[model samples]
Target chain A: MKTVSPFLELESGPRVKVILDDVALSLPQGANLAAALLAAGVPVFRDTPISGAPRGPFCMMGACFDCLIEIEGTTRQACMIEVTDGLEITRIHHDEALA
Target chain B: MTRSDLAIIGAGPAGMAAAAQAAELGLCVTVLDEQPRAGGQIYRDVDRVAPLRGDILGAEYTYGATLTASLKHSAITHLAGAIVWAIEDQFRISYTRDGRGAQLDADHVLLATGALERPMPLPGWTLPGVMTAGAGQILLKQSGVLARDAVLVGSGPLLYLIAAQMVRAGTPPKAMIETQTRSDFISAAQHMGGALRGWRYLAKGLKMLASITRAGVPRYTSATDIAVQGTDKAEAVSFISNGHTQRITCDTVFLHHGVVPNVQAARSLGIAHTWDAAQQCFVPKRDEWGQSDKEGVFIAGDSAGIGGAKAAEYAGTLAALQIAFAAERLTREDRDRCAAKLRAKLAHEQAARPFLDAAYPPYAQALLPDDSTVICRCEEITAGDIRGYAKLGCIGPNQTKAFGRAGMGPCQGRYCGLSVTALLADARGQTPDETGYYRIRPPLKPVTLSELAGMEVTTPDAVH
Candidate 1:
């Protein structure tokens, strides 16, 4: 569902690498979530419903319970979640059975 | 910056009475109120449309003018429509008026911001056709507009008073639903003995009941489960009474479950408060003089607690006397005598409170409506979202933040705090209050970034 909410827009930044829930990801400069995860330098995807499973961004504007991950020891709504360089995101609940 | 010996923050009965008494004792007083008109909500002028000729507008005309004129005669100043947004220990106040922010200083301050009707979320409560009984009165009294037909729901002295006002104004309501059961009336009666000190008050309450009876407004006592039904507006309401579902089709529903203190100022000041289960709202703790634990800060009237106009008047006098006595303006004996009179008034008000509470307990069932019910009207968050968070091991508001964005809305949990507590209790098989709602932290209202830009930031040297 396309939804409208408030967000601080940014422009013109260098690509930074950050990890969300230990997920290694490369993001554009000024891309908040991408920058934070690459800075954390972990390659984890998402979080779990129960055992802190791996989850990634779903509804970013604070709607839809999808893109929730622990960043800097605080669980934040991913869409509304801002990103910075060298940030660490942790996974809680719904652990992935690594293949 | 303007300064005064005492700054009163409302022009209601308590504020007016306090200012008058303090001024009479040779204290310089200034009354700052947010209304263009002197009288606050309770004694709002009804003279906008009709002439001040009848007994109906008698209280407003008498008290309002007398208070305004008294302040004029004595060493008291009146600043109307001044919204005092912040207060500190040194008696500095920040207020906004005419789109400008200003600060005033005082030696002593009395806060009498008064009360607001408890917001109950029935279906379509946010619709245009629904309003608080108090709001309805304001529209009729201030704006001279009346709903073609209104259904007054909830019970208490105010309920009957408003109903009588509506009926007398030729805008008779279709029904008056009393949520208090007859059985509960017994408890309410126990407090009647205290109120029996005044024959006139008893007579007035009886007269109101008589008026309501004469209006032939259907009284649905022992009513439960009130539901307002409408898509874009409140078209009607349904309630189950005596094991039967009855519906009242009306254009407007005026609801007044009870009153809650306007705690924005109190919370911002960090004054300690205790839950007043009787009124189902938090009341600031105060001494006999209405002085809070926060030094140099005093509370008065319903803001200290929910007392009627009469009780509030006495409380104002008591608070003023205490301040005066402390300043050595009055002997200890005079303060004690004043305190004795205040004690009597407080006792009478307390005695009547049980009857009022029993007559209208906070409609607990109203908090937990159907799952599809919208808990946060501003955010459109339904009861289902709350439940979904709980199912995902979300223990409380803090933990629930991870699972679902419940309470992460513009209101900052004011509208949903009580309901969220109730929902958490039901999920955990605990009491609602035990679940514990969110703490009210300051900057109560949301302020724009630009507004914050002009604010004075505190430095380490400014701490003292």
Candidate 2:
């Protein structure tokens, strides 16, 4: 089936490249960073402490901030912020805020 | 240092009408709309490519377009693509333009900021193909693209309209799976009786539904999300009914629970808010005049509540009249008559809301998406992490910050705020509104860091 989605990886190429936790990886060009990471087999975005229910990006727009990742040492909107080559994203942890 | 006697925050029905009213009363006004053009969501541009030939936009939108156009000749200053970032008690607003920050001070502030798509999270909702109904409509109407061969899911009056639009655009959805049930609609109809106060509105809903039926959109009521399946993209959907599983293969899925006020600026302003249980959202309490508790702050449009564009226009006109009367430009009798007419229209609009609300009950899906469901997709946090942080006795969002770092990652809590609030609300047995969404500060859209750096930064005036 032919599909066209604004958030999909059409051609297999390094659409955008970003550094996750300082590790470099190339994502499908123009794909959402979260979706790209998921496609790349990076399952977790952040962790919860109590019941341990895993949550990810639900609303892809900036409306549902479940997809907050630190980029260039500042928290940025992952969906709104397009992926750029060498962009650095640091995963936030449940206990990280205490720091 | 742009200046106006009254500054309206949006150019939708509310803001445009209010600006026209105020200008007619001899006050200088400025209307700021974020869209490259005017017309809020309801009167959104239909297919920027096909560009609804002025005649095709129907009377309301075309009339609104004319009204907005007429304001251009008034003393009203219209700023397109200007996103107001913050409001001060003295009626000054900070905003960004052409990658620079500027400030505008007005004697009176009217926030017609409008509404936002309500976030409804479910399993596989993070998939690439899933999107809000509004997003799909925007893509179709503005981009001339359709989410065809798509699964239209959710419970709202908008869903059918979306399907109708898609059909009208020559690409209807593969199926319409509604989370609302017939029994739920029975109550919705009983609620509609209250709305029957006016014949026009009753006819409107009928016309919309008739259009939907004519479109031949297949519908499934009492439906709920079971799962969205795909490896990297959504290739299929599996929903359940009466403990039975059903599956459909579709590349597109549109979801919307409802809409909530885009209250970031309002919350940042620290206005007292009351929970409208029927509406299931926190809205600023306003007088019959649309004035917030703040003396000079007025709210109109969906920012006040969701009563569609007509109500917004009426509210906007009344708000402007209030300001006009307050400024002593209008006689007492004129003000009273306008207010009376507006009040009656408001009462009629308010009547239809209960029916709409009952028709769309927020479906409670098992949100805790296993231990692997990513909670903070940006930070890569899992549901496990959120629960772990909550176990540390993080009672509220602020407290959770210290324990699990839930709301601190970025997007400044816009993306994860709703789900986190829903999770915490469920945990505490509180309603979703009690958990409260995040604070909306201005530059509603993302502003480049340079914009903030260049801001005059007037000592970061107290939010209040």
Candidate 3:
């Protein structure tokens, strides 16, 4: 585990390449997308629409919408999505200026 | 649309048990679940994660596999990864799966949608690194991930369980800030008789606490005025303990007080709900058999109320037995005989709740945080906003929609509904029942218009 990362992965697996905000990442394939992102040091899932405040998963059970992120083309809860090869993920925000 | 004699939404202990029991009684059952597998939040990803981390997660989690295994019957069809959005009339359930929408009709509908952690709203809860202990547990279960140097906050057995689980994972929490005070324990002592009858739950909690103690995680009880300290993301937690303010620096803050019944679908279906004073949330009204006031609808599991897993399983089977008898597949006597043990077991499982509820009431500050604390994350609405709306003559959560758009965000107030109700109730000098919750409607979860457009078009729903 890296000293810089706030989270530590308990298991090791073959990494699959994916891109977040145009940055290439070798995330563990089939792992929870939210956990993988947090472990990889991407804390901000999406900025709020009104205040542009940073947010991440809270409930992680699909109840809280704080973890919403754009996967492929649609905005979905990162906690509910699985990391896969070639998955293009980015911040999901209604505020265009923040984007 | 697929048709079945019974349709169960959620594949947790309740849904799976209900499906198995009803199917065994010659009823065709279909169980729809959001996860790719059966285990609900309590034992999420059981089959996949249990084999690897069963000891860390503890035995109670792995036990869910027994319920999951029962779904292998041919009479029971399990639809995994299905997000149920609408529960229409006549038991027509609409859901989205893999970006596609589908509908199913059933003779009876059992909603085991389950419970969600009652939001612990504080100054910096919306920050990136702040999450619920349940969320942390989910990462541990689903992906074997653990937060480094995290501080656990709030009250209840769940906090202790997660702390111990983290300890077992070889990364104990830096500290635990407890909200339950000495008076809370004194009040909880009144329920000792029931607590005694439910000794196993008490034993489990003690065992978890023992593990945390063994790991030397500093635990502070009676913490108050708790707040996360950070600007952009969570950096630490600040709280008052024993008349002194203390701050613990940590990247992650896991906050939890207790869980409340996930009542979105139940309320959307227009099931009658009463404000549960002890649990401090609105719960759907149901009979002993889990039959709701609505015809042909049954609410079970934590979705009905926060009864935990074992109670939910028993409740589910009881509901299924009642449904079987109503369907005329089983005689009334037969149904009663089958449900006799289940009802007893359900009551037994619920025996310790009174003590737990009194001991770990929702954090007072979190229930109504300071003026600047954000209560509604979706809208960035603060507690002061709701209190302001009340001053402007807003008496209910529904009025907040027009007064300030407090709960009109994407989540439709799931996280902030209870807090809004409490704020309004406190402002208006009324009880929570008088200050009713938001009137929920269908398309419960956020669903894209395209998903609805592509849904099965036959037999259009009459616009309400």
lDDT of 2 by residue, B147-264 (tens): 5478888777678667766665556688777787777778778776776775666676677677667878767777765577886567787887655678889877888768777666
> Which stretches in model 1 have alpha-carbon errors above 4 Å?
A1-99, B46-54, B57-64, B198-200, B387-417, B421-437, B446-464
Give per-residue CA lDDT, model 1, range B1-464, as digits (tens).
Answer: 67788888888878878888888877888888876556677765422323432344335334555555555645888887565767775777776554355667888888887776665766656554566777666544443345556798876777887787777766678898778787777776776665565555567778888988897878888888888887544668899888889998976678877777766577677777776677777788788789988876678888787877777778888888877776678899988987897888677666655556665676655557667776654455667777777787767755554455555654456556666766776787766445555655544433334444555544323656
Ranking by DockQ: 3, 2, 1
Give the DockQ of candidate 2.
Answer: 0.11
B-chain TM-score, candidate 1: 0.87
Q: Poorest 10 consecutive residues of model 1 chain B by lDDT?
A: B45-54
CA RMSD of each candidate after superposition: 14.9, 6.9, 2.2
Q: Given candidate 2, what's the lDDT at residue B302?
A: 92
Question: What TM-score does the predicted chain A of each candidate obtain versus native chain A?
Answer: 0.53, 0.71, 0.88
Candidate 2 CAPRI-style tier: incorrect
The list of candidate 3 runs beyond 4 A from truth reads A1-3, A97-99, B460-464
Model 3 C-alpha lDDT per residue in residues B1-464, reported as the tens digit of each score: 67899999999989999999999999999999999889888879898888898989888899999999999998999999999989887878889988888888998999999998898898788988999999999989998989988999999999999999999999999999999999999999999999999999999889899989999999999999888988878998998999999999999999999999988888898888999999999989999888999989999999998989999999999999999988999998888888887778888899999999998899999887899988888888899999999898887899998987888887888899999999999998999999899999878877888787887757745675
Q: Using lDDT, give the best candidate's number.
A: 3
Best by DockQ: 3
DockQ of each: 0.01, 0.11, 0.86
